[model samples]
Target: MTWIHLLSKSHIPFSVYKMYKGDSLIQPKTIKNTHILVILQGILSMYHVLNKTEVICNSIVYTGHIITSNDSDYTYNYISLRTSYIISLPITTTDLNQYIDHKIFNQILYNYNNTLKQNIDINRIFIHKNIKFRLIQIIIILSMKFGIIHNQKIMIPLIIHKIDLANILGGNINTINKILKDLDDQKIVTYAKRNIYVHNIVFLKYYCYLLR
Candidate 1:
C-alpha cells in the first residue's frame, strides 16, 4: 500500500537489482542524468578506488535509504557488503515534476539529500581522528544500522572482515587487526569468524566521545 507499490502497479518503470555479498554493482553505462536507488535489503559500501588499489569508502547505504545517482561519469563504485536487494528507479527530474505529487517528490529528494549530507558529515568529523576512534565510530554506526538486539547486546550479523574495516577507515590491515584485538581484550566487542558482537556499547560510546 506504499507509494513504491503504487508506482510498481502504475506506468513508471523500475529495476530490482539483486547482489550477493562481495559482488560489484557495476553501474550501467547507458544511464544518464539521474536515478533513485532504494535499498530494499542489506547494505552497500559506496567507494572510489584509487590507482585501482586503495578503496576510499565514501558511505554506507542501509536498508530503506534513498540514494540519488546523478553522476554520468560514474565516479563511485558500489559493492554489496551482504546479500542485497536494490530498487533502481530511473525517474528523471522531468518525470518527477510531471508525474509525482509535488509534496511527495520534494520529500523524496529531501530525504536523499539529508542522508548524503549525514554520510559526508561523518567522514568529515572523523577524518582527523585516530584510526581506533574511526574504527569504533564505524562499528557503532554499523551496529546501530544493521544490528539485532539479542542477549542484552547488539550483534552485527554481517560477516565484515578486517580488510573491509581497513578499507573503510583507510588504515593498514595490521593496524586494524591490532585495534580489533585491543577491543576484544577489553571485552568491548568480540569478533568471531568476522562477525561482530558488541558486548559493551555504552563503553564504546564513552570511548568514542573521549576521542572526539
Candidate 2:
C-alpha cells in the first residue's frame, strides 16, 4: 500500500476509539444507524460468519450497507490483533446525504475509495518480504504521528506483543519471534514487559531496506 493521502481533519465528529485484545465492541448484530470506521492506529480483525470471511487491519467497513448477525445470542468478536485506534463516523441517513454533498469531504472520500480499489497482489514466496516492508512503512507513519522524546530517543509508547505483530504483519508467531530476536540481537530494539524500546530507529529503517 502507498500513501495516497492523509486526512488530518474530518467534518464529521471524530472520536479516539480504542479497544483491547479479545474485546468485542461491535457485536455481530447490525445497527440501524450508519457508521464509518477509519483505522488510525493498531490492528483489528472482523469476521463475517455468514460469508465465512475475515477482514484484517487498514480496512474500512461501512456498517450501514453490510448485513451482519442480528441474533441476540450470536457473539461477534472484534479482536484487537493489537492495541488499536479508530475513528468512528456516526451519521444518520440525512446526515450522510448532507455530508456526502460537501465537495471537500466528497473529494477526500473519493481518493480513499479509489486507493482501496487498487490491487496489490502478494504471493507466499514473497510474503515475508512484503510484510517487513509494510511494517516498516507503518512504523515510519506512526513515528510521525505519535513519536515522543524519551532520553533523546524517538520512542513509541505503544506496548505491542508478538501475537499482535504477527497479526499486523500477516505472518505467524514463529516468524514474528524470529524477526524480533534478530532485531534484539542487533541492539535495534529491546523488549521487556510488553514494551518495545527502539534503540536505533535509523538502523531499523536500514534493515527494512535490506529486506527490500
Candidate 3:
C-alpha cells in the first residue's frame, strides 16, 4: 500500500473522493491550491479545449499513482476516464510536522515527486516525429505504470482504449492502428480486445534508447 492509503486508514488528514466518468474536476474559472491525490480506482485525464475545435490531452493519471497540482498546473480540466475514487490531501509545511514518521513519509514524497518529474520529461515523446518511437515510448510509460510480468511477457492489468492511447501519443488513429497491427504481427507485442501484452521486453525496450 502507498502512503496515501496509510494516511487514509490512519485518519491522517485525508479525504477519499469519488468521481464518476466524464465528471469535471476543474472548471475554467477555478483556481486551486497545492495538493496531492492518490487514484484508488480508475484513470483521470487532464485536457484542454482550444478554439472550440482543438482538444489537447495533457496527461493521464492512473490508479495507484499520486498526482500533484499547483496553481500553474491546474489550467486543464481533469476528468475521470472511468469511475474513480481518489484521496485528496493538503501538503503544507505544517502538515509535514504532523506525520508520525516524518523520515519515511518525507522519503515517500521525494520518491513520488521524482517519478512525477520523470513522467513529465518522458511525455515529451508526443513531439517526436517517428510514430514508432512515439508508440514505444507510450508502451514503456504504460509498462511502468501497470505492467505485470508473467512467462516472459509484460501485461498491463487494465483494458486500455486504443483511441485514448492515440490521443495521448499525439498520433493519428490510423497510424496507431497500423503500428499496433505490425507489432502484433512481428510478435513484439500482442494486442487484442483493447488489451496490450508485451511479448519481448528486451525488444520493446530498445526504442527507449532513442530518448537519450
Candidate 4:
C-alpha cells in the first residue's frame, strides 16, 4: 500500500499546505512538536541554507517521500518545481508503538525505509568524479520516478533551474551546459530551460555503462 492510501484510510491528523511553482516553504524555527512532512503531490527541492545566504540543494524530493526533523541540522527551504501539496503529521517515537500492527504504520515504515535507501544510493553517486555519468544517472532516476511518456520520449515535466541542477550534481554551470549540449548534439536528449526530453533511454543507459 502507498502512503496516500494509508493517509486516506488512517485517522492520523495531518495539515495540508499548498504551494505554487517557485514558492518557498520555509521551515519553522520554533516547531514545538515534531512532525513528519510528506509530499502528497508535486516535486520540491530541499535546500540547506548557509550563513543565511548561500543555499545548497541537497535532494530532489518527489511524491510519497517523507522528510523527518532530524534529516538536517540546518534550516531547510523547500522550493516547489510544480504546484505541490504537502502534509505534516505529528509523530513521535512513543506514538508509533500504538499503531505497530496497523497497515498505516506499516506503510509509513515502508516508505521511510525506501526513502533512506534512495538517499544512500544518491550519496554513492557522488563518490564518482565523472560528472557526465553522474548527470545521466540522475536523469535516469528522475525519469523512472516521475517522467511521463510523450511521443515515445521520456519527458521530465518539472521546471528546474540550471543552477539547481548544477548544485545537485556538484558541477559548474558551464560544464553542465556543455555536457547537455553534447547530448543534444548526439540527439540523445533535448534540454532547454530546465525541461529535459530524453529521446534515447537505451543510449543513455549504455553510455553510463561504458563510463563505468
Alpha-carbon local distance difference test for all models? 0.76, 0.52, 0.70, 0.77
Select the stronger candidate by lDDT from 1 and 4.
4
Q: Which stretches of candidate 4 lie over 4 Å from their true place?
A: 1-10, 26-33, 50-55, 93-101
Model 3 misplacement above 4 A: 2-11, 19-24, 27-29, 40-43, 48-51, 79-84, 91-108, 150-152, 207-212
What digit string (tens of lDDT, one per residue) describes model 2 on residues 1-212? 11112222334454556766555556554544355555555544443333336534322122111212234544444556456655555456775665443553565466455434421211222245566566555555445545686776667666667676666556788876776677678887666676666776888788877877
Give per-residue CA lDDT, model 1, range 1-212, as digits (tens): 24367556555677788899998765543466466777778788777645456557777776766755666554567888889988776576777665676555665676687678767866764575599888888889888877898788799999998888887787889999898899889889888888999988889999888887
Best by TM-score: 1
- lDDT tens string, model 4, 33-58? 47788888888777777657687666
Model 3 agreement with the true structure over 1-212: per-residue lDDT tens digits: 57555676556687788887667676343555545666766777767555456767766676755665544533566778668887776666677567546544774576577648755865676566787887787787677776899777899766667787777667788988899998889898888777789987777887457444
Tell me each candidate's TM-score: 0.85, 0.55, 0.74, 0.83
Evaluation by TM-score, superior candidate among 2 and 4: 4
Estimate the lDDT of model 1.
Answer: 0.76
Ranking by TM-score: 1, 4, 3, 2
Model 3 lDDT, residue 165, Cα? 73
Top of the candidates by lDDT: 4
